[model samples]
Target: MILTVDVGNTRIKAAVFEGNTVLENFVFEKNELEKKIEKILEKFPNCSDLVVASVGNIDKQSFLTFENELKIHFLTNEDVYPFVNKYATPKTLGIDRMVLASGATLQFPKQNRLVIDVGTCITYDFIDENDNYLGGAISPGLRLRYEALHNYTAKLPLLAFEAPELYIGNSTTQAIHSGVVNGFVYEIDGFIDEYRANFSNFIIILTGGDAVFLAKRLKNTIFANSNFLLESLNQTFQYKIDND
Candidate 1:
């Protein structure tokens, strides 16, 4: 069994994968890394290999505490990936994006892939059928958008994410809902359409906290998996084990 961890900006999500099947899932706050990892190890004592991708501010050395318990592979920019990372600045590319693209390449092979991750920040990563990791875009997330509007400009009240009843806002709160929520839906759909316009055999994969809510409204076809990064990490880890 292999333990895969994706340490994002706000939270850490871990999963134990027995080949392609996820045996268990764990979530923890940034500071509770040690305890969450210990719990994963305790519950699944058979796990021998552990892989972690850290894009957050947490120090990678912290995971070294488990070195004696299992073989730990900490993913970084230097790691060899299955695909050619053609990003202009490869060293600065986020490991999460790289692994997510790798997961798309491995899981949905021989296809043009666009991975839209709607997490703390909305990120778009693309890998062509040739397995070249082309860079994508990034923008503020749902909460960030709401918070920004409220914080920067007075009178725009901070509103939580909720689907607007209509495209037109009936009131202040509803307007924020439309602008923040509906606007993102349009932005996502627009991106998908633009990508499809240029590529053939294109696949759009949506994953993140708000993917499910947006997936229901997107006009195009997409493979939505909330735990996409974790799944991708497992595949990336296997590739590393085979090649390294």
Candidate 2:
């Protein structure tokens, strides 16, 4: 079995896979990562391989402790993927993005694919039809947009991300929600339109904590795979095993 962990700014997600099949998956608050890892270890005693793709600050010592407990190889960026990594600063690239791109390549071989991860920040990644990982963009996420407004300015109140009824908001709270949520919808739709015009038969995959919320507003059809990163990590393991 393969254990995949994705530590994001707000949360840590872990999954156990038996070969290519995901057996169980769960998320933990960033502060509770070690506790969750211990629970997962206790639940799955036979996990043989581990892979971590973190996008936030993580305690390397805790990860090392877990690795020692399991007695399995923990995969990281030092390991190569099945496809060529064209990122100029590969070491600086977020491991989650790399793992997600690797998963996208495996799922859509010889096809153009766009991966949008909507979490603390929105990350857009593109993998071309030739199996090349063409990097994309990153922008503040829905919640971050709201938080920034509240944090940066004195008057703007902290608002939760909610669906706005109209583009023109009637109240301050509604205005903030509209600006963040509807703006993201338009941003995503416009991006898709432009990308579709350039690439033939392009595929869009949406994942991350707020994926469901954003997916509800997206005008374009997209494949919503919540466990995409985990799947990607699993694919990375398979690629390593096959290549070796």
Candidate 3:
């Protein structure tokens, strides 16, 4: 068994994979890192490799401590990838985006892929049929939007995400809901529409913490899987091993 970990901006998502199949998934905060990994190891004693892709601020030494239990490999931009990264600033690309693009290129094959990750932030990554990693956009996520409204304004309350009852909200809370939820959905659909107009054999992949929450709300068809990153981490590690 191989353990794949994705250290995102807010949470750490880990998964145990047997070949391409995910046996189980785990999510925990940075403070619970060691305890969670110990529990995971206790449950899956056979897990020999700990593959990690971090885009968070947690210290590298924290993960390195696990070196006594299993082989730990951190995936970085320097790692071998299946696609040609054509970003204007290639080094500035996030590992999470790179992993998502690699997963799309390897899993979908010979198609234009647009990967939208809705987590702490909304990220758009596009890869062409020839496996070229073209750059995409980023925007604040739902929580950030809500926090911004509360922080920047004097009276708007900090609200959690809920589908607005009506398109045109009658009350203050409902209006906030309307603007944030409906507006976000519209922005996503609009981007997809623009991309569809320019590309052929295109596939849009929606993943991240909010993937399932926003999937049905989306007007465009998408392949939604919240675990794409962990799966990709496992696949990318295997690809590196096979090719190395």
Candidate 4:
């Protein structure tokens, strides 16, 4: 069995996979990292291979302790991957992005793929039909836009994400919602259009916290999977296992 861990900025996601099948998945607050790991280990003692794709700065010492206790090979970004690493600064590349790209490669082995991750920050990554990893764009996310409005300006109240009634909002709160949500919808559509024109039959995959919310509003068709990163971690482990 493969134990996959995706440590994000606000939360930690863990999954237990038997081969390609995900048996169970869990999400916990970042503060409860140890407890979550302990629970998983206690519940699923058969988790033999551990793979982690972390975006946040988690404690290395804690991870080391867990690896020693579990007696499993903990795969990190420093490990080898199946796809070509073309990022100019490979060391600085976010593990979440790498895992997403890895997942995309595994899902569409010989197809041009675009992966959009909408979480704390929106990220775009591309992998060609030949399985080469070409980097993509990153922009502020929905909540970031809301927080920017509240933090950068006076009198602008902090807002949470909600679908707006119309494109043109009549009031302040509605206007904020319109700007963030609609703007994102338009931006994503525009990117899809541009990319589709250049690459034929491109597969787009949407994953992250805000994926469901944005997927409903997207004009383009996308394969929406929240467990993409976790699957990627499993794939990464499989690659290592196969090659080793």
Best by TM-score: 3
User: What lDDT score is found at residue 117 in candidate 4?
Assistant: 88
Best-first order by TM-score: 3, 1, 4, 2
Give each model's clash number: 0, 0, 0, 0
Question: What does candidate 2's lDDT look like per residue over 45-136, in tens digits?
Answer: 88876777776887777777776666555566778786677888777778888888989999888889999988888899998998888788
lDDT of 1 by residue, 138-243 (tens): 9988989999998999678877778898789888888889888888888989999999999999999999878888899998989999999999999888888789
Write model 3 residue lDDT over 1-244, tens digit each, in one string. 9999999999999999999999999999998998899999999999999999999988888878889889999999999999999999999999999999999989999999999999989999999999999999999999999999999999999998898999999999999999999988999999999999999899999999889988989989999999999998999999889887
Prediction RMSDs, each to the true structure = 1.2, 1.6, 0.7, 1.5
lDDT of 1: 0.90
Model 2, position 30, has a per-residue lDDT of 78
| Winner on TM-score (1 vs 3) | 3
What is the per-residue lDDT of model 4 for residues 183-227, given as tens digits with 9 covering 90 to 100? Answer: 988998898888999998689999988888878889899999888
Better of 1 and 4 by lDDT: 1
Return the TM-score for candidate 4, rounded to 2 decimals.
0.94
Better model by TM-score: candidate 2 vs candidate 3:
3
lDDT winner:
3
Model 1, TM vs. native: 0.96
lDDT of 3: 0.94
TM-score pick, better of 1 and 4: 1
TM-score of 2: 0.94
In model 3, pairs of residues that clash are: none
